[model samples]
Target: MVIVPILLLLLLPFVGAQWLVCGDSGNYTSNSTYQANLMLLSSTLPNKAVSNTSVFATATVGHAPDIIYALTLCHGDITDASDCESCVAAAFKDAQLSCPYNKEVSTYYDYFMLRFSNHNFLLANSTEDQMKWINLRNTLNFTTGGDSITHLLFMLLNSTAQAAANSSRRFTTSRLGVNIVPTVYCFMQCTPDLTPHDCAACLQVVLKHTLKFLDGAQGGRILGTRCSMRYELYHFYEGVPMLAIPVVNGTTPAPTPATRHNSRKRVLWIIAGVAPLLSILLCVICSVVWTRRRRQGKVNLNDQAATNRPEENELVWRLEEKSSEFTLFDFSEILHATHNFSKENLLGQGGFGPVYKGQLPDGMQIAVKRLASHSGQGFTEFKNEVELIAKLQHNNLVKLLGCCIQGEEKLLVYEYLPNKSLDFFIFERNRTAFIDWNKRRVIIEGIAQGLLYLHKHSWLRIIHRDLKASNILLDQDMNPKISDFGLAKIFSSNDTQGSTKRVVGTYGYMSPEYASEGIYSIKSDVFSFGVLLLEILSGKRNSGFYQYGDFLNLLGYSWQLWEGGTWIELLDASIAKEICTSDARRYINIALMCVQESADDRPTMSDVVAMLNSESGILPEPNHPGYFNLRVSKTHEFFVPCSNNDVTITEEPHGR
Candidate 1:
């Protein structure tokens, strides 16, 4: 019998133990042909990293449709070949287990990184999706000399980036200040294949993201497939810095009086000698360019107009008279405020994209939503928001302070609410205490008033197609403010409802008619409001409410409890102790009424407000809600039914 060594077994757990997995899961099935390719690719990647002299390798397995692209990279600090190989191997195994059937995944181990995807992420265009950022929870703010510390930190980062770009290893470590007590430590790297210019550009991009997101952060990293950056108050990396930044008292030392006088004399002599020659060269070049343009004037006009026409269509928002209430923010200003959309500045991710917390130069806080390029929100939706939301004013609704549009980038700026969203408090077990019964009631009433304004009093008859807890922002005082008008629809005075071939909304919150038949009205909004109401009351997400047992969603579960005379069980325990039984029951009954099977059976927002506010009236009983089954099949095709965690059916539905 073969004997296994005890020492090797003992050391196994210690090898590549510290690591993190990130990136979104791709759509791929398990135990399939593609899955086989992924498994084969993962196995191949570790061996390639071990065998390769550079400790980096990329490989592709299988053909076309089922093809898998895989790559592995070892940090320059990992000098031991065996250790690098072990890290790669561990990353491969962990990535497969952690991400399961995800077709695109990345795992970062202490000594190495392993990434595999069905797409060609090595290309420059695909790098955006492969980017990830990590920020230390701790912050550093020097009370006495803050500017000097900040200035030194950035200088260190910039110098290190330049060194990494020029190095053959495509990696560099840097330190700020002397060995006695360094102000900061930084490490940077890029894939070896990138040219110096490309590597520098990539690092600069991440630096911009860091600037916005890591302003007061003690440590952070912007990790990407092609390039990466990490900095900290103390040395976290394995090796000594390849470069060191000298500490400046303020600026570089000034030249002596004699040296300055000599320098000025030399500068004057050079300028006097070159001025005439420069003037002649400039005139000749300008004359030739003007002659060529005059000759091609007609063709240039036709070509210019053709190209400019499409840009004009995209830039139509610029034509709108800029409102003082909603400034048309410049893209540069937005970048400055949000640190180029740094991940650390991220408040939360919504259906459209990530929202970031930023502060203007004047110290006014703002929340910026940088719309994802691939999101469902298009130019039409952006225009709709700027046109509609800006015109409608309500204290209960979130204020859109401004917007930014430049090239492919689109962003919306709003007044920053410090308490975050309602979901941030209600969904978390510990945080639910921050919002008691009185606060929850206040939130519910505020939402109803916002909806009332949209349906009856606002300038536009708006239907907020997607309404959920996450979309509800809370102020410093915990007052709720309705937000996100991307999916909202406008209704004319004469029209009460609208129909479309495409349906879009959060799964449990979507009205049955809207989800099943692509029809939405003011009543659809009311149905969504009911789902939000139930969520607030129960402190559970309707999307994954299976924890409540047997029930498909919160609506069905609430209905079951109401029927059995055990409805009080649905109240979030945090609030249940103090909530008045009768008042809670009335709110639940009204919520049930809003989610009735037929849209016609649902109350108007105004009526809902009245019912919630009334003290001495017998409310009508609610009927069965639409799609209130105990079981829904997890299986789906085309798009994951629950993937968007919502149904956005593109095909026409057969009406019941």
Candidate 2:
């Protein structure tokens, strides 16, 4: 029986009280049959054979522990028994942690969701486009394209399956050229380590779902904890990439900015410089005119603020040292780059109003964030961020390129890192493949070191109250730079912890003590770190995890595996290829230890840094993590087709 995760927010709230309940603790919430089925599937799949594509294994867990376990092999890619166990275990952990308490939760964890249903759930044979069409047609006014479309989709699915089945990574993407020259973009991927045919078969299942229900609309994806397939008539991809499509006759656009600028300069120089220099008489006439302009010198500062170059000394705030290597750009230069804050140039809206990318006159790049006056929640954080970053300097910490505050505008500038953030890579399939073992390990270590500096090594003992993936910026080399210091706190060296009536932080990343009781400290950062480590290793998010296997977060699942001596099973497939098995096991052990249920049991950031940097000795075994014992409810979701966010998903709350 397939387990489907459920979403139910049927909470019994007291006027002013919070209650913790679980089977071991003596209080348990009894759920309905439907709830049970949802929870069962929400629990991770115990085992699914990639060879058994016949059994549908789509699972989503709610806040309750109700996911049922099952095994179904994909058509042809079955491998050793070890691969099956690991995939299921990883999937279960993912669903539980990432889709924490929500009722409806679904993610492509490992390959499948071992789930159960309240009613007889029919498995349908469909393609992604067909299902999209069905959903759109039933929901909107649209025409049906008939069996011809379905047949075409089926053929595309088979091709992707065939390719995936042949590759060890078990993933394939292709554009099928149909009769009208319509390109059907299809993508298929199974657990990375899965053998070829299993990948193909697992993808085939998703393809079937796409054709069966969606009915070929604009776009939709059929995703599972294991393998998945996605197709769209529309191009939904956006990122920095070199397209794989080979062109038979078109000239490739120059990939670098320097090339384009050089080409432009070549044309401009001919019009002004070369043309003027060619004639002496014309040059003398121009010089005389220029002399006349020089005679009009000593113009009073009509607008003292309106310097073409914004003065650097005007906005410097309490600087201990200065680094001239980096350019200190003025606000006006930035305004021009973004066309005076044009809505069209805006990249994304953030807590601090909006962030814009800019190009300086000299071709230097920067990211400008204009703090919004209406952002009440962000005001304090924004001021705090500007103050904190100005005082500290480190490679892993985001470099504060400059700041601007003239009149009403409060703009903070940063060295624009081309790769953006960690979230860009971890939640997508196509992108995760590029973050090799070396790169991920570097990111993990850099974050740890950066956090260590904040907590202990910095001039002031600090706590990054808000730590998440989106805050972790990735440089061009894929190096991670921890950012967003607005929520940071300066704690006295002797203080072990603190409490607040108003607690702030992302839900999944927040430690139980902080989230539920307002208690926080260095240990809280440790808890977040543990989650980050798990996410880096697994490429799954901790928040919105839907698998049902009796864990409230990824920490709990990692602890169970470490306790069971199978923690290496949690590694992301892409990371697994290069992982030294022993090191992988050690890393998980350290991560679990960092997330121990009790604050006292968790290691300091310093200790974590030592453990990561030094492979000297065998680390101590980790006990069960705190805050992982909550019993979650579950819900069921019908057959959905497959899709991938080019980057792999991390199991940590950083992405939340």
Candidate 3:
């Protein structure tokens, strides 16, 4: 493995001169205003680019016809800021000379990219008109592992693209190894200004175009104005790669012909000499340990039994002390309040259990969630909700009065709201008209504030892994309150994210990273909030919206409308005329930003709340949403039936 990388490095090709593309948007005379503005931006952007953490900067100089929009992006792995500045500074000078008097130009160097144009290409949604270049080293191809090598290369490229899109710098490098082929190194990046979806899309297009010309080449690169990808048999970029996948054990090289006989003889001789002694030693150790454990087992069991009951009592006492109003209800009292758990008092059925409407002895109405004996969510989730929600207090959050754990039954008691959940109104056609623009706006802001509190201001930082309309309860005044903390996760001050092998979340509301990779953070909740916000605005369920046009979900349909400048078409007909267009657009933009493909790209709950409350300010353009192309067949519709029940998925979904 060490020898392979060294040999490949020695065979690396020489770095070449810059590549340039003069745009078709016309040219400027030597002394024109456009030329002067371009000069001004060129002088300042390199310094700005080097100072920025992403090593990228954008500047617009002058106004109207003379305005020049320029962008400078340095290679992400370049460690020294001065090198980045110098590379960018050199690109500006080269662009003017190479494209001579062109008002619009794109220049690419080995270490940086610089582009300026008369038009705002920064706002472009498509890369069709952008510059594209493909470079291939045709001298070598994989003689061994043929199809496997190709598969590995493409897999590396795809994963690299995803990592780059999710990264704050919009850049990533990866390497993978296989015994039949030399280790492959890949580099991928996009301009920082592009949305995560656009970045991924751009790289996908570049890969498709580049693959047409590769034809088993040992190394190749496809470069474009928005995104770029390169893969070679040697490490090509500076610093450690962001991802590295070593070869499987069986894939490692076997002993050579000359060494095979000697290696086998040496291995056999060692095993023969060591096997009998190891077996005898292991048996002796096991016998002694087993005898000791057997003598202590009864004593340990007695001690554990003595301590267990006290610990359980102490835990219950601590929970009661934490919240003064928390009460442990008697099973008989619960049965009487809900009229023997009658159907008339039944509220709704959830993934974990069924809820019942009950009136306490004091005449205060309450909602009782009875945990189902056979639920996938069991005692752990019930206990989690009891501890978590009891400590959290906010106007938009549902109030947990107490809990009851008696025998085999576990029950949570919450202050009941007469209007049920947001899904009851928003999803049903007949009930949709009841929620006007004002009510929807209030509900959206309320949910944002609730999430903000959970993520930032609460006693414990919480990530509500499953947040959807069904989890949002509406009061008599039609105000929203976030409920259901069964799947919530607590984060300490230093923790920013977490991962799990068992991914759990509603299908349409799950973030791309969480659903596919089992990685989640506060951003996962933000993505769910975005889906709920859109549902409120459009009076539609994301999972059920696939029947419309060719779009697979609400996210894709809304994005297309927003991109085409016809976003008004996405507004619910009930509130279309009642709400101001600007407010509606702002809400839609905020929702889109929340549902961005990359978790890093999604706004924090605080940011979401600020955006929701502010009537003015230019919102950032949202990238295409996560799961924009997730397709479900008619037979598989049962997976996401668009009902109130939130499904907990143990197995990872096939795609996002």
Model number with the top TM-score: 1
- Name the regions of candidate 2 deviating beyond 4 angstroms: 1-331, 342-351, 377-379, 406-408, 548-552, 634-656
Best by lDDT: 3
Error of 2 at 407 (Å): 5.4
lDDT of 1: 0.72
Alpha-carbon RMSD to native, per candidate:
20.8, 31.6, 27.8
Q: Can you tell me which runs of candidate 1 are displaced by over 4 Å?
A: 1-315, 545-547, 632-656
State the lDDT of candidate 2 residue by residue for 1-656, as single tens digits: 11211211222322322111111111223465434554454343444333333323443444334433222323122334556556555544444454444333323322233322221222322121111111111222114544455544555555556666665456555555445335656556565544464454445445434544455454555545455565666443332111122221345465587676676654553343223223423534554564354323222222222322221212122121223233334455678877898877675555446778887778878778787765443323444576678777788999887766444566878889888878778867778988988998899999998998888888888889767777789999998999877557777788778766555566567776776677779999998888778878888777664552456556666666666777777788888879898789778888888777778888999999999989879888776776566445464432211223111122333332
Ranking by lDDT: 3, 1, 2
TM-score of each: 0.51, 0.47, 0.50
**What lDDT does candidate 2 reach at residue 153?**
52
Q: In model 3, state the lDDT of residue 100.
A: 92
Q: Local distance difference test, per candidate? A: 0.72, 0.57, 0.75
Which segments of candidate 3 are over 4 A away from where they belong? 1-324, 631-647, 650-656
